[model samples]
Target: MSANAQMVAKYKNNFLKEVQEQVEMGEWVKMCMQCGVCSGSCPTNFHPGWEHPPQEIFMMIRAGKREEVLTSPSMWMCTSCYNCIVRCPRKLPITHIMHGLANYAHRLGMAPKMQPTRHFAKLFWNNCVKTGRVNELKLSMGLYFKDGFGQGIKNGMAMKDVALGLLKAKRLNPFEMLGGHKCKDQNGIHAMLKKARELEEKRKAIKAAA
Candidate 1:
């Protein structure tokens, strides 16, 4: 076979089980019409090549192109807006599936290239590993000054509105918000992370075998 043909053949051969290993999410496993509603309704669909659209990802998964599906940064690109879920013809919770893919990828270390996201996840781990809850002001401000901080950075000045409201109500103190606080559910978060890590390790071994 020509090199191009050979490459195509290999790609097809490698897609099946790998895609199934992505873990089914919500009703996304069911049949779907190739309508662009999900993409149209998606609030962040306009985002940079961040997501591959639920239809495309689901199609790839169904086609068994596991590596391609798993490696796509689209999963992490989801803003979790749930617009797709509300507009689905079959009522599949597309957003949930997106997260499921992300978790699976993260577990297998096959997650798409997302240095900033991984760094954010590391921050999450660091905070949870320490006090449980994040130090918002620090995390927020730190993220603001950093490039590629995700859309979350856009909320910088917007939060002053909330801060002012909070100050008026005396519900929160600006200084207090700066310091780190232990999570109210620290133990639960710890337990969940521990369990997730263990399961991921087992899955990694299984994947390596295949």
Candidate 2:
């Protein structure tokens, strides 16, 4: 069976339980009281892409709408402004839960494929993790070229003035395209990240077993 299928069977299709056990800080999802305060407080509340706000997401989880919740682009829309968390009467860690849901959906390969936020997040994470530092130039190029060469050229041209300004300010380095500066202790950084991944996997395994 596919990993997702196996997980579905293992969880007996109980998406809420799966989320609670698998997602970061997901156990707190039950604390939501459906007051709509979180939805109202969101800065992106006016955004049409927000198909379901925080409280609605929690409600969907409780209602067992697994596919709808996981595949929706709503979670990816969070900007992590934390307005929902601050205004929530239950004091729920709403920001963490939203990100947790997004991460969980990504891991299961269930997130919307074309979601811009998810795409940018993947690009940013890969760019930074490689050298333990961000190569801003390469990151920007990657984003520009994500659609196609034609679109990428257009994007670059459109941002040419901004790029030139950055170059003049010494903020953008063209040489970074070749190889940019990296962390001094590259091996140490890689080792530390590897160890962290191992610990995280072990923790998840224990949670799954429990």
Candidate 3:
């Protein structure tokens, strides 16, 4: 049988089960009705690349299109605006489910390499891990320069207007961005994060064993 056929077979279809086990929000995905309300509510739906909206993604999960669901640009496009959740007749937390899928994709090393949002998320986490806080300058630099120095400069130039607006509003302090900042209790933060990671790993192991 083909891979798709195997996924459709009763015993081989573990996709939904796996999703429910791995992502807290994934349990609600079974309730999706493909009504397209979630898609209509999403701000990113107008973008050309988001082929699978929340409803389609939910159906994909049930259909066991594991790689396609994981690599989909639709999952990465969610802004967590809560619009989908608010409009969902079933009251499914579409925003949370989208984020859960993204995290799951990253955890399984299936995340699409070209996803800028994923890149920013990793950079943001790295910044938080090192200092217990995000230094906007460093985070921005890491994201812009992620591809390379030349790309970074180009990205920076593209955002010049937004940066200038931020500076004018005092939201982006030039001095702080240049100097960076550290948490007051860096050791305590590290210890907490380490414990959290350990617990998360334990949880994953238990789920896998099940």
Candidate 4:
């Protein structure tokens, strides 16, 4: 094969197998006519220092520019408000493509370097898949100490009313917060979480290199 042909083959997007199999909302990518409705409907213009809108990311994916698509800043900024889905001429859920790209970036260890954002996402994902639900108190307290006691105190105060209400409604138990074996399989949960953290660390190292 010619060098150009070989390079093109190497960088081509494998969106077909991915879009067909896992993603439930990606059917419209093929039907996209390059009308800029999605770009116009984006609630806030996050584009800066870029020549094109998010449609370019979709274009790159369609064209098989794997490296460029994965590394683009536009892939990570999706707020998922679904404005583009509502406004799309082809009725494509453009937001889903953004999310699909984000998930792909996360799996590839190439997600953007918003530390707090990344940290919260890691913690949330770990909690959900491992525990089936998030213990927000645990997350908040964890963040508080990581940030500072002042933030903790401020957080506690900000949540004072909510805490009181929860207590009133019997929605929470302080004893549980203090020390409770809420999960029937706490050991299993811990083991799974440990494995998840190790994988996350490995992915971060890989992303650093990528």
Using alpha carbons, what is the TM-score of model 4?
0.58
C-alpha positional error of residue 146 in candidate 2 after TM-score superposition, expressed in Å: 1.6
User: What TM-score goes with each of the models?
Assistant: 0.66, 0.87, 0.84, 0.58
Highest lDDT against the true fold, candidate: 2
Mind giving the per-residue lDDT tens digits that candidate 2 earns over 115-142? 8989998998998888888888888889
lDDT of 1 by residue, 140-169 (tens): 665665654564557666677986887799
Q: Quantify how close model 1 is to the true structure by its C-alpha RMSD in Å.
A: 5.3
Q: Can you list the residue pairs that collide in candidate 4?
A: 13-64
Could you tell me the TM-score of candidate 2?
Answer: 0.87
lDDT for each of the candidates? 0.69, 0.87, 0.84, 0.66
Per-residue lDDT over 1-210 for candidate 3, one digit per residue giving the tens place of the 0 to 100 score:
999876565332678888887875777899998898989888888887687888898988998788788877778888889999999999998999899998898888888988777777788888878988789888888888888999999999999999999999999986975664887899999999889889877886787788
Better-scoring candidate (TM-score), 1 or 3: 3
Ranking of predictions according to TM-score: 2, 3, 1, 4
Give candidate 3's total backbone clashes. 0
TM-score between model 3 and native: 0.84
**Candidate 4 lDDT, 59-171, residue by residue in tens:** 76677776666655565556677888898877877887777666666777766655454566667666555555567667767766666888889878888898899889998
Error of 1 at 184 (Å): 4.4
In Å, residue 195's CA in model 1 sits off its true spot by: 4.2
State the displacement of the C-alpha of residue 112, model 4, in Å, after optimal TM-score superposition. 3.1
